[model samples]
Target: MTRLVVVGAGITGLAAAFEWRRRRPDDEIVVVEAGDRIGGKLDRIRLAGTWYDTGPEALLGRVPEAVGLVEALGWGDRLVAPATTQASVVLPEGRFPLPAGTVLGVPASADGLDGVLTPTGVARVRAEVELPPLSLPDGDVAVGGLLRERLGDEVVDRLVEPLLGGVYAGRADELSLAATMPALAAQVRGAGSVLEAAAAARDAGSRSRFDADGPVFVTVDAGIGALPAALVEAARAEVRLRTPAHGLRRTAGGFEVSVGTAAAPEVLTADAVILTAPATKAARLLGEVAPRAVDPLRGIPYASMAVVAIAFPVQDVPAGSGLLVPPVTGRLVKGVTVSSAKWPHLAGGEALLVRSSVGRFGDESQLQRSDEELAADVVADVAELLGLSRPEPLETRVARWGGGLPQYLVGHPERVAAARAAVGEVPGLAVAGAAYEGVGVPACIRDAHRAVDALA
Candidate 1:
């Protein structure tokens, strides 16, 4: 029997093992996780009689990989779409509804941006249509710089920064446009004017998935944690929790992995190995095995963050889904999700759950605070943003994710390719995780499938 070992029991690792088991039932499969739990960032907790995902709460259902996995796991019936998708941005004065028909805060013509942008900012975006033709950068360019030249600094600061922050926990000024927003870069390169390009692209998108009024995101009643739980259950693999892989060595037949403490270590041998650990740990584990890929793997930076879930009476909750705060505002909290409003299931009648995200690239000091301090700061920020009195929450829970989300910097694709090439040199070995590709659940699943297939 062919023996395969998968490290790090996160969604990516679970998906890899599950797919491999489905394709080869006769093979031996073992999954090892350093954490006590299976899910990595897909964590869920119960407080005040309701379930809340302290980590990633929903999956972009538009991706087939996510929806397909849900259906395949027989959890399709449990899937619930957001009741409200409307969100706002927190400004100096207060909250302003995000204007529609914009792709990642890049408006088509700045027509409906009265509350979101200042008069001068609106005029600057409108001027993009008449602005001179600009040549695109050859390889990679910062998203902020590109938009600032085409649109203006005010628009990029006020609009694009918060939107990109919500997704990448990164500022557009430092983020790579080609890696983060390829379509926008391509459109800007082809069209003479940025505004015209945005309009044309929006028009085309209106005829595609972007215009679909259906649910763009989906979650289950048990929370997104249910996804990894189900995948781990379905995978025909022997799971070892709290058992970290310390080292790996290549043998004549395949590979040998050292597990547990160095004092009394246990080594397991396998014909093939799939490492789904985070970038830092994966690099360390492969230091002795694949030195060539170490630099590229270590080059990928990770952003640390914390989530504060506060439960309040439904009466105190807002109507919209959530609100994103721009870094320029200098708020302790970056964003707040009206969990009760976004996922009706989370409401469950009695209490309204609201979760606030804190910290981003170069702003990780906030994450170092104690849970009590972090929660207090988040509550204060929430009250100020919503213009409500600071009322005591019924219950509060804090989840800290250090080095959670990976940063996809400029030339990230090339770096990932180099890492893969180095790993390919070692037979029957592969790496898969959010560090290499997209950070979404769907993307992790897709990456896992590719890793498993590579060995086959």
Candidate 2:
């Protein structure tokens, strides 16, 4: 048998193992997870009989691979888009519509931004449109600096950061546009100004049909975890959960991994290995094989965050999809998803669900907060942002993800290139996750296919 070992049981790993096995039925695959369950971050938590996805709640329809994979696994019927465009951006005054002529992070002329911005802010932003776009080599640009130079600090502060916060889970300065969202960076390069690009798109009628095609987000009835579960079921590989790998050494035949348990550690040899763990963890594992690659992998920074799911009476919450809070005055959170209104499937008629995220590169103090402390701060902030007073949550569930979103800092593409180059020296080793590519479910899935193809 062509024994291949796949590490980690997250969505990326699961999809990889499934695709690998389908292509090579003779290969014996072993999937080991440090935790007792397979779905690493993809999980659903139930509070008062209602389920909420603590991990990625939706998959972007922009990427066909995710939809195709779900269809292949017979999960097509489970996919459902939001009924309306309740998604809005939160401003100092109140919640405002995400503007009409904006695509991704770009706006259609500074005039369109007028809906949520002041004339002064718009003028300041317009000045940047005339300035030249970047001339750097093909690599990730610091989205923060790029936006500030091209749009204005206020635009980056009040508009761009929140839009990006939801995706990168970090500060604008800490994220690399090339690594996180190259499409947005490409927009900057192609049109000199985000406004010009969006205007061009609008003229072409390349607008968002949110209600029909899904409001930029899609999910299943059982929860987002269904996708990973389906892959695991399809693969039927040897799954050893709670069995963290402690060490590894390249034996004469292939390689031996130390599977550690409280009782004892067992050695298992495999002909090939697929490392789907986080970059830091993978670096520790591959240090012996590739020293140069391991250092930068270890250097990649990650931000801690918490997902707070608050349950409320249906009438208590707003009548919109979600509210994204810009980082400028982002007191407590990055955004709030009005779950019951956005996706009725996940809500009871009498109750409402509001999901919010707190703590990024700029808010380390909040990242260190205890669950109760964090919940208290969240309650206060929600009240201010959503216009709720004396609103104690009926049911609140909090999940803390430390070192969750990797920070693809400026010059990240170059570093990633160096790491990829050094990786050629380490045979039978490959890495995949949100850590390397754009931080989205689709990006991870895309990397999974790429890694499997490279290995095969």
Leading candidate by TM-score: 1
Task: Report the C-alpha displacement of residue 208, candidate 1, in angstroms.
Answer: 6.0
TM-score of each: 0.95, 0.91
Residue 258 of model 1 has an lDDT of 92
Q: What lDDT is obtained when candidate 2 is compared to the true structure?
A: 0.75
lDDT for each candidate structure:
0.84, 0.75
Q: Indicate the worst ten consecutive residues by lDDT in candidate 1.
A: 205-214
Error of 2 at 110 (Å): 1.4
For candidate 1, the lDDT comes to 0.84
Q: Residues 307-414, candidate 2, lDDT per residue (tens digit)?
A: 898886566555487788886664778888877777759655656678888877756777677789888789778766777654767888888877777888876777
Q: Candidate 1 lDDT, tens digit per residue, 1-456? A: 999999999989999988998899899999999888888989889966867898888888766777788888888899899988899888886678888888788888878988788888888888877777877768778888888998888778778888888778887888877777766666777888877667777766656562167588988888888778788778868999989999999999999999976676899999999999988899998898899999999989989888898887556656399898898788988788888888878766777678888888988887887898888888888876765554668888999888898888887877888899999899899999898868889889999999998996
Which one is best on lDDT?
Answer: 1
The RMSD of every model to the true structure, in order and in angstroms, is: 2.0, 2.9
